[model samples]
Target: MPARKIKLSTSSKVFYVICYTVVALMAIICLIPFILLISGSFTSEQFIRFHGYSLLPGEFSTEAYKIIFKTPQRIIRAYGVSIMITVIGTFLGLLLTSMTAYVISRKDFKYRNWFSFFFYFTTLFNGGMVSTYIFYIQYLNLKDSYLALILPMMFNVFYLLIMRTFVSSIPHALIEAAKIDGAGEWRIFFTIILPLLKSGLATIGLFLALGYWNDWYNAMLYLNTETKYPLQYMLYAIQQQTQALASIASQAGIQVQNLPSSSLKLAMAVVATGPIVIVYPFVQKYFVAGITIGSVKG
Candidate 1:
């Protein structure tokens, strides 16, 4: 079969050109900084000191990476910690959030509105950081604990609302039919409701992963020992050490041997950002579809 072509008016043609132009420009705008970051990471420290950063390296060197990996054990351990927490947190958080949202989404469930309000209210008002910190430290005794890093991020109120809205849009008749089949609530939820929430699950899962991967605040507050530090916090500690070395060298009127200050910063940024950026492509299709469908009704 021949495809029918719909002709566009002159105005529509011009609009298409404008839209494409805007999108192309935006893509370049997002890409240029990353290009500079990669190039800067490879640049020699001395060259960067005199020439500043360039899109291409003034003189290429791997000393920055060498310095970062000089103590390979530390960096590798941090990487492991970060990866472990991110995986565990994302999986558990998604399960809890989806289950909670599913219950609230059901029309026949008594007191769903009250429970929804209870969850939603937390988003608007929360105890201040000081009190929460005290509670976690004193009551929970979570100091110097990995749970400190994971628990804070386990469930986000906003993500819960998104999940609830998406699940609510599923047909009532479908759920009724599931019940008529002698399927219990747990069975209906696990087998039927979950299968249909793929897009929403992908969207929420991505959000949870990013949150866990990039988390440094909780690590900073709760983690006292070096081995417990995640990658971001470890990188931060390295940056601080570099800065301290620079300061000491200046004070002693001596040259700091292999001060990777500039390149180290750029390299750290790349290392920290690289993995998570790779994740977006896998979820990109589900992300757009999920947000659009979930937000359509609510």
Candidate 2:
């Protein structure tokens, strides 16, 4: 028998229409700021000061972008540093975190609970920033090195827990079948387990990459060489210098040449944010799958 379709009541239809309208409005609101940021980056300082920012640039100028690329070498070097750190950190973090989670997820691992607790404990509490800084600098001797950035963020307790939970949901029969085939733990993990963990790995890798890309604090604290500065820290330093110069120019009642401080800030933000924003769409399917899988326990 064919099922009859049910029609919505007038009130129900009205409610749905209202809901859709509200959601559409909310989406536009979220998009507005980014639109302004892009347009404002091309705007001239005089127009910005005179008329304030607009969705369309008040006066089209590439001055802000020009300032950033004035030293093409520095900008390229910073980008290179950020990319290298992000790739290395993401790869290492995924490898270590997944390996640890695999061990903890095994039902027959005698000390799994103890090890899980040990990792989880760090999430609840940690040595303060001062102590951590001292340890990394004084004891580890990581100052002025790329290792300083890579090591601190290489593994996250929360990520480990998420991976463990996801792995726990996999049928024990798979591991047993591998063992019956004389497959060792390492072989089983690489050939069988890791393939099943794709969504979780993508989610974790995206997070690790974003963390490394956005990191500036570690670089500021540990790196002394200009060549070692990552994109975010270099941008930050440039922003600070621009602000200082603007302050001086304002006090002296002098015009600074081609210093579009406000627009340059917006431009710099666009540059810093663009690459990671592009990454989200590619990982979004796996990200959603990971979240759905992680939402409930086995």
lDDT of each residue in 136-229, candidate 1, tens digit only: 9999999999999999999987788788877877998998998899999999999999999887888898878888888899998898997899
**Global local distance difference test of model 2:** 0.84
Clashes of each: 0, 0
Candidate 2 at 7: error in angstroms?
5.2
> TM-score winner among the candidates?
2
Residue pairs with clashing backbones, model 1: none
Error of 1 at 33 (Å): 2.7
Give the TM-score of each candidate.
Answer: 0.84, 0.85
lDDT over C-alpha atoms for residue 199 of model 2: 72
| Candidate 1: regions farther than 4 A off | 1-25, 243-256, 290-297
Q: At residue 54, what lDDT does model 1 achieve? A: 95
